[model samples]
Target: MTLRPIRLLAGAALSLALASCGTTYSMPGIADETNSRASTMFAEAKTAAPRSPISESAGVNRFARVARRIEPVARQLCETELAQGKAVDCDVKLELDREMQQRNAYFTYAEAGNRSPVIRFSVPLLQDTGNDDEVAFIMGHEYGHLIGRHIQKGQQQAIAGALILGVITAAASAQGGGYYDQTAVENSMELGAMVGQRAYSQTYELESDMLGTRISHAAGYDPVKGAQFFARDEAARSGGGQLSFWGTHPPDEKRMAMVLATMEQIQGQQALTRKASQ
Candidate 1:
């Protein structure tokens, strides 16, 4: 078999596979004005004094309150936005990770029975939040993951990437008229999986932020203020030195800009609705 044919086939398959994954919803476009404002805000956050962490009890109470409001809004949005006939689980469960020391939150399916979708917030992350809006915004962001079907897409991408790379590696090894190099193909597959899984990572984050803005606003929270949670120059690791929130959700001016742009879109939509009603 010619290496060129195998390479071409692998490339075509890879493109097709990756193209099948990604966001189902459109992301908001960032205007120059919003970008400038986000830059200023990001700069200001760096110099701003750190606020005191809320007491653990206060944080828990705040989380409970925010969850009560955000959960329904998120579920409704998920159900409304998801295409009809899709089987995505809109009933997302909210949980507090009391045992975790890191400041972080994540959305994932439960490992055991039924595999229900769950969003978990660490106690430290809750205490670190500045307000109820921040809590609501973060929760909504996690909900975005579910609505976007990021986890599922990521899994698909990983499999595609691995297969494509493995095929290419095997073909290249065979080009020498030698036995298949299993070790080389396996190593390449592992690398491919990692690369593919992260291919849309940034885009996914922005998509989540965009959806998060709408969800937070519907829950009656200021998303721009809530997004300030990302502006600070805080450690990505927890006090215990484990990777935490900032590690995964790195601080980026573009994210702030995306949130601002999304809010603008939301406001414009609301105004149009009001005018239509009038």
Candidate 2:
């Protein structure tokens, strides 16, 4: 194939891949006022004294309480989205991770049996939370990942990226000779996949935060307080050098700003609803 055709094919593949990924809901824009407030909050959190870790029993109790409240609310939201014709799985299983030492939580599909979606919170991470609001927020955020179908979208992006890059590499190699360099094409595909996965990760995190805010608020938890968990200056990796919660959910002023903006938006929506009801 000619270079022009090869370029066109790669562009088409990339466009298709990108079309599959991204937030279904509108992401709130950060206003200047919200950004300033978030900056202040972030700065204050960095200087604030570290919260003492709770005992295992206390942690477990807090988790149970928060989970009890947040789960139903999250599920209801998921069901609503499904009813709106969103291709999302509303059935979510919340589980505690007893083995991992790192402070982290995640949502993923179970490897065995039916690929059921499960959200797991590590024991250490639970113990590290300052309050139930923090726990509720974290749980809500994980639920956002499910509602947003981020994992599924990410898989599509990776496949598209790999395909696009692989094709480009193969076509380039075939330009001089009729043969393509298999190893080079494979390497390019791997690189492209990594890029695709990482590219929208920050955006995904913010999207989750927005959804989490709504879920937590509906569940009667204070999302602003819950989001303070992100303000802390924590290490990205654990003692063993593995990626921890901070590694995945990096603390950022923009995230705090997004939360603030989302909360304002929610309040505005509530006011409108109340006015209409009256």
Candidate 3:
């Protein structure tokens, strides 16, 4: 029997509380250690890639110029969410990584003793990206993840799922007067966590894309071109099969469609604002 609908509703309710809670950056622990490891990896990758430093590359300079313009705008939006109690205050840091070949970017919570969230852009992505709008859109998307607190929400949801499954496993075993071995309990909990992680994966991606559309537009970039990147990627993945049911992200085509929808919404809102101003 499918319990997904019920599970989704419960998870959503729990997420409200989880998402609203603020983060504490006091002592170092696993999270801090993980952050340190990632930073070290980025640093090491720089030397390993053998590319000119981002500071010395003209293309990267152009990328940085656009990033500088969008950073403050993105932070202001994040601050607005904080003021409205939608999120905890988080400093936003944009860094360029000139070593990784992958065209990728990510947002992570700040290291211990630091309250700022960090966004890293791979050098190849910066160099190969179509234009300024694409870069701004990508940065804004990472900011969207930060303000939305998706990472924290995902962790909380996973723990909730694990706990719920653990209880169910014990109760079911007791009712049936059957053995519930520790191994079975552990396996159930692990499976629950895996399910929980996938629960909001697509939703988070779409919401971030929507928020990113508004953000990039507000930062004076055309979101249409921002969306082209996905369509281009989708074309490249044409031979790939449909996204798996257990996947943690929406398919590229779905993401492209979402970007288009979000762009339309933003444009409509802007038109209304312009009309109201006159």
User: Could you give candidate 2's per-residue lDDT for residues 1-278 as a string of tens digits?
Assistant: 56787887788878878697778789977789999999999888766666667899898899899999999999998999889998887888889999988889999999998888999999888878888888888899999999998998888788788878888788877677767678888999998888777778888899999999999999999999998876776642243445567667778999999889999999999999999999
If both were scored by lDDT, which would come out higher, candidate 1 or candidate 2?
A: 2
- lDDT (Cα, tens digit) per residue for candidate 3, span 1-278: 12454356446646643653333211112244434543443333223322222333755776688787788887887788778866555677778766655556788766787556788876656655556887778777777778777787778767767766755666567567787567877887898787776677666776677667778888889865765544443223222432211122333544555566566556667899999999
**What are the runs in model 2 whose C-alpha is more than 4 Å off?**
1-12, 235-243
Give lDDT per model, in order.
0.85, 0.85, 0.62
What count of clashes does model 3 give?
0
RMSD in Å for all candidates = 2.3, 2.3, 12.6
TM-score for predicted model 1 compared with the true structure: 0.92
What candidate 1 gets wrong by more than 4 Å, as runs, is 1-12, 81-83, 235-242
Kindly give the stretch of ten consecutive residues in candidate 2 with the minimal lDDT sum. Answer: 235-244
- Candidate 3 ranges with C-alpha deviation above 4 Å: 1-56, 234-250
Q: Candidate 2: what lDDT?
A: 0.85
User: What are the TM-scores, per candidate, against the unseen true structure?
Assistant: 0.92, 0.93, 0.72
